[model samples]
Target chain A: MDLLGINPVLLIASLMVSATPILLAAIGETVVEKSGVLNLGVEGMMIVGAVVGFITAVNTENPAIGFVTAAIAGALLSTIFATLVLYLKSNQVATGLGLTLVGLGISALLGKPYEGIKSPTLQSLDIPILSDIPIFGRMLFSHDAMVYVSILIVGLVWYTLKYTRVGLVLRAVGENHDAAHALGYKVIRIRFLAIMFGGACSGLGGAYISLVRVPQWTEGMTAGAGWIALAIVVFASWKPWRTLIGAYLFGGITVLQLNLQAAGVAIPVEYLSMSPFLITIAVLVIISARGNQGAPASLGRPFHASN
Target chain B: MIHFEKRLNPSRITTVVTPIIAVILTMIAGGIMFAALGKPPLEAIRIIFWDPLFDPNFASYSRPQLLVKAGPLILIAIGLSIGFKAGIWNIGAEGQYILGAVFGAAVALAAYPADSVLLFPAMVVAGAFGGWLWAMIPAILRTKFNTNEILVSLMLVYVAESILASVAQGLLKNPEGYGFPGSRNLQQYPSAFNAEVIANSGMHWGVISAFIAVIFAYVMMTRHIRGFEVRLMGEAPKAARFSGVSTTRLVVFCLGISGALAGLAGMFEVSGPSGQITIDFNSGYGFTAIIVAFLGRLHPIGILLAGLLMALTYIGGELAQLMLGLPGASIQLFQGMLLLFLLATDIFTNYRIRIGGSN
Candidate 1:
């Protein structure tokens, strides 16, 4: 009972905070995949963002600048992948994997000096009267600006994907590249932009971790959150709002596990530690069992104009 | 404007030549990186690529270690290449490796003080079985539910890591020692040891298995129908299915073989070089083997050479770190750059850039 004595408001609030990174990443990847580009280097891109954001924040003592730089860094890394897969027509899977390797290695090398370094903290924006409300206020109103920014991004992505002509064209390109090309849509250019957007969001996610969540720089600090974000895209069935749901679900599991550990729950610490990964994957398998009809038809295939 | 023209027939010369070109480019890029870090570029490059094999001072020690390090990489890559050729990606060989080591060590530990020679062989089987079982999760899920094997397998690695930490700190803990977090040193146990067969040559069972696997894979790919089926699936899956190749069977076969080989690598490593089942026993050999498989162009002979080259970097990277005061991360960055360069140059194998071409 004591272990179960969790404050629901606090849990929901922290869940939103924890989910922000993956939400940012998954929503961004949703856009990229919607445009028919599959980039598995999200993990790599996020780590680069984490290190770059940490470094920028340390130097400027400004979290916003840190986040912007992280986005730039992430977008920059994505360009390498875009160039390889789109221009050189390299195998998408292999190139994405290579991108991840590059991101991880470069981040580690660059983050060496920043190791054990504390990042400048971002203050949570507490809405004056809204934050004063007993339970809901604390849950909904008290978070760093990035939390709201992630939700806003999600809403914007959803609106863009569902209502906009650009979204239709992106979807058409993903559904059938040749037809889209015949229709005079520039497939490569569109995919490149989408990938860059994905990179930016992933960067924001990484920066959020370094600046707000852990508030510290560590090697491989993003850990497997990038991978989880990838899974979240699939879990969301490529829908932005579902992506939000999936992220919060994952965030809930993560927060709950940590809370359980803190409360000295009787569960084996190892299982608790592994629950996020195991549960996320298990749920993905279950969701996929219903069918992954949401996957872009040309998702993993490289777009060759000639082919 | 220059545009790439698809080759009607991929150049045979380019197939063999691109890896070499990539290596040279890596050296050049790595030298620049060293220069950026204030170290003498040539000296850093030499220490990494040349000194490991030729320098009289370090070659004696590093040369033998090359095979020792390459042993697991080649064995794992050989198995992975087969799966890769079948379009079946098993990215969690690291997990399979850990489970294999755990199962093998558990067998030996349970049979403590026993002198039966069969014990080591039994452990090997148990190790292989453990890996096979671990790999089956993703394989079965993929076949039955159409789940993405890549995500499933990769996530399993984390689960396996948690289990590894738990086992090392709990059941497998060396009780005789003052609360240490590892198993009994299997290297010290006569019956369970994977000792070097040849004196100081690093010719242990794992290295021997790697060579055997290389030969076996080469022969299988060239002469076996199953190998042809595997290649067909990867190159053209629809055609493979039409040719009566059971997709489920191929997936199971490839995943099983890779898992078993990864397990053997872990078992040999734990009992011989690594000396015990520690929480940190895995040294990313399984993941690195993925790079090795690709670098080898998914060919057996190519994988062997790639494995050796990669191992050289590991040894040379450590040496460079010690001698040049370079960050240890520099090697990881260098290797990543090598893979990037390799993939970039691979474009030449299938296409040629032509001047003044329009589609």
Candidate 2:
């Protein structure tokens, strides 16, 4: 029998699971920013996803449908945001914050009945040879489909951003929307699609939490994960590979603090819990100090297309 | 052929009518949502907006609460509107609010055994300073490193929450009480309490401060050179620089003001309604203030009216939770929808849409 001891490995695994939501949310936010629209409502969207996903899973007895429904709900919510920012030319920051407020309210109303009930757990999938491998296996490969898909998403997004014509067009639009508009491209359409895609990704990330991570609906369940993800997007400098690095770095610190808490270190649990935010501030400082992190030139500016 | 056109002015009637139209539309949409939830849409709408202010049983308690809840929101939003107008986003007001509570509570706790009038004022000043100091971190970082203030300030809220939880649980824990995770009740100490200045009327120092903030904000926006610069900066950054406005100084000023106001609100909550520095004392006022700032169209008078309305919803929401079994957070969402709808309809301010599409 295994002796009564602090399992660093298991603790780390749980941390990864916790960090997954942030990673997924931040990655989506990074993409949204890259396309030159700063949508700060990721937290709102994720929480919406959490409630929608939880309700769907509960009703259907299927987690995959829950994930899909969550993504759709998130995108639908984001569409409201898109209509305002894209068509109305409202301040992105203000409208995004408003979207968050709306999301939080809607979710709380939706989730009141679902509270305290455990969601059906998301099954972990094991890769054949990778599952047998040491600590690296569980940490890297042998996990839920969402984890691997997030990695694949990062790679795909990076490649598409760097290589494809669509990537060039997107980057070009972000670099100068006015210029892109003159070149006969629809600036509003591109930004709209990007915003929706970001919302979808954020929704799935929220699903991972409600359906798998905590496996329960809690008030403010995403608990500023959306905000952390928003910061991580800035930390990554609108780059996909950098997003991966930024996410895991955040993930690592987040997990380490929890492990320290469970390991019963001398440090207070409050300090450990607060470590992720502090680390984010520290990392952002370092990134800015080092130099420009390649933030898109047109980010957060409302593009009014009349000459 | 190219047509270059500018529509500069709109009738005063449209300006007032647009927000009402947006509100009506939001209600219709919200009704659909309620229906989807299997609730009577009209009843839900009536309960959300109307009954709180008019209903006999709830109105007595909720009427007084309106001023109390609105007080801090108005103070915080007025502070934030200035910064937002100056093109400096201070999203960390939540952190500032928490820090304010912590600092004020710390002062109250340190002077716990001392029953002196100086205790409350000292704590209020300390709380304002606490928020100012927290906000300054981002201002300095942004000025020095050219860092993103949005991320810096927003992230600090979590740090502030952690600190709040830590202090509430350990350092400030009431000794006489059996290990509860909060400080001594300021309300119990008459010298430190922030009770109504006028008995039975819901008038407190916080409400008084909110009125003062509105007057100050109005004067600043209308008659002051600094206010002109703030509006100019948001509309045209290049023009602001050309007009010899100091971006760095303005950043510090705007952020400092917002943080201080937010802190004061937190201090008031700790002293008055909340009465103690508990982990759950903050009810997302910082985030909600962003809503008030926008809903009020970033104007002081607008915020004053908007703050009152938001306060009503908060009181109404609590009532709904008790009576209709509606969740508390739906109020926040309803308030958010006010901004969303306002922003969406604000397009009419500049552009007229044709039936098929904009022409």
> Cα-based RMSD of the predictions, in order?
1.2, 2.8
Q: In model 2, what are the clashing residue pairs, if there are any?
A: none
User: In lDDT terms, which candidate is top?
Assistant: 1
lDDT of 2 by residue, A126-167 (tens): 988988899977766568877778888888888988999888
Alpha-carbon shift of residue A294 in model 1 (angstroms): 1.0
Residue A261 displacement (Å), model 1: 0.6
**TM-score of chain A taken by itself, candidate 1:** 0.97
Q: What is candidate 1's CAPRI-style docking category based on DockQ? A: medium
* Model number with the top DockQ: 1
Q: DockQ of every model listed?
A: 0.74, 0.69
Give the runs in model 2 whose Cα sits over 4 Å from its true position.
Answer: A1-15, B1-15, B352-359
lDDT of candidate 2 over B166-264, digit per residue (tens) = 988989889887987888998998887899998766779989999999999999999999899899888889999998998898899999999999999
> Clashes in model 1: which pairs?
none
Q: Write the per-residue lDDT of candidate 1 for residues A1-307, one digit (tens) a residue.
A: 2665777888999999999999999999899988888888998999999999999999999999999999999999999888888888887777777788888889988898888888888899998999999888889998889999999999999998889998888899999999999999999999999999999999999999988999998888888898899999999999999999999999999999988988888888898999999998789889889999689998888777773
